[model samples]
Target: MSETAPTPAPAPKRRSTFLRDLVIIVVAALLASFLVKAYLVRSFWIPSGSMENTLMINDRVLVNELVPKVAPLRRGDVIVFRDPGGWLGPGMGDDLVKRVIGLPGDTVACCDARGRLSVNGHAVDEPYVVLSRGSDRVVRDDFSVTVPAGALWVMGDNRYDSADSRVHGTVPEADVVGRAFVITWPAGRWSVLSRYGDEWDGVPAP
Candidate 1:
């Protein structure tokens, strides 16, 4: 009667090997991250002040690689592209980052009466452009051009210092690597890269 409780089934053996499980999980996570970086997103660091307040030197950013392929490029998008040709001088990198100012077929001009850049007769309010020492105009020089098919006009937020479309010429869309959507470094400076949507509201289709 005190027949003994069938030796409590040896406490069910733990099926999970702790160390092995952990290692497997870690490996999987790293592989997934690698895949994403390779095809979907990638990281880049700013090397100059061309993007200033929006993207400071050494600031890290996450770029969406599908842009212009899966996702359409917009006028205010911050993009990274390879030097089309002669865009970089000796000692400089082959890549550059700039904001999209004109799309293919767009008529882009500088300095309306208010010194704001114009696209298709609409004056763009660029709150992002930084004035250089003693400079009041966002764009100091006057120029006008129509973006060619399969090309994009780009410029830096630090207009005075950047040698962008104004200096080198329109970048072929094929050369664009990606669009920068966020700033990810210098924890204290973390922020989403803004497109300043309203600024392009008045711009007409190219």
Candidate 2:
């Protein structure tokens, strides 16, 4: 074969062409985020002090919108769920986040002689709860609830200040929209949310 000429290098892209490519890249990124928000995870605005000491009002968190499909719900997982029945105002549709205290068929009660919560007659130690003034081991209030089938009993970390499942009763497990996996706002407070792994993980499923 005859010697072939060296192939010429491709021409440089025009400035306008470079800009168009950048626009496409930005649009693709935006679309990816939009899809995540709609189908996988979404950011939520904390609207109240219900979960204080662990999550503050106005702090932001990312919720796995498809949690029900990914894994089974467990005790101590922080979950966000829609207003179950009268939990919200008439016609209002909103979600609330709280730690799961009881699973379906579990009996959750407050304050044993040592001031700890009991599940199925076994006392559970909660190191994250707010304490009574000057008493480090005290958990406030006295209430007992047996979670119904297909429901969950939830409570905020700020025991004395929250109006959670303790107030309106157990919420339908079907109403759980997602599990909050992280705090995304207030960079100083940014961190992954963790459940009571070694502490309560061994509790039998109801």
Candidate 3:
């Protein structure tokens, strides 16, 4: 009866791996963040008042890199791009943000009696344009130009103050980095950027 075999040695205890699992999770999260920043979205801060009430100076925005690549651009979509040469002067940054005013082959003009910008001969209701500091006008310049193929005419909500396509000329589509889709910083300023498609509803194709 006392011949019971010696108790088998206690099975070896498995070591806890919480730290290993945690490290793996952290690494994976970081990698995913890096990938998103590199190919899906990126953050940029407003360096000036070009976008105004829409994007104030120092506002942080999230730009979707898929746009104008996976998604075609639309008039009124805010975008970020490299300066198309001579657009930026000394001390100015190479990258800038503006709203699409004209697509390739579209004619863009300013002030249609009612102070509205016109696209393809149709007046657009630009509720976003800010009135000049001391005047009732929104746009300070009166000009017209047809956007060339593979280029886009852009402008700012602060029309009178922005040095945009009006001052520098159309930006090549190739120079666009992405479309800015949202304001992410300054919790009070959080909002989705609008394409203002309705403003272009009456605009005819060019």
lDDT leader: 1
Give one digit per residue, the lDDT tens place, for model 1 in 53-142: 789999999999999779999999999998888987897887889999999999999877778889998888898899867766788889
| TM-score, every prediction | 0.87, 0.82, 0.87
Backbone clashes, each candidate? 0, 0, 0
lDDT of the structure predicted as candidate 2: 0.84
lDDT of each: 0.89, 0.84, 0.88
What is candidate 3's lDDT per residue for 63-98, written digit by digit as tens?
999988899998999999998889878988889999
Per-residue CA lDDT of model 2 for 141-172, tens digit only, reads: 67788888988889888887778877788889
Ranking of predictions according to TM-score: 3, 1, 2
The TM-score that candidate 2 achieves is: 0.82
* Best model number under TM-score: 3
Clashing pairs in 3: none
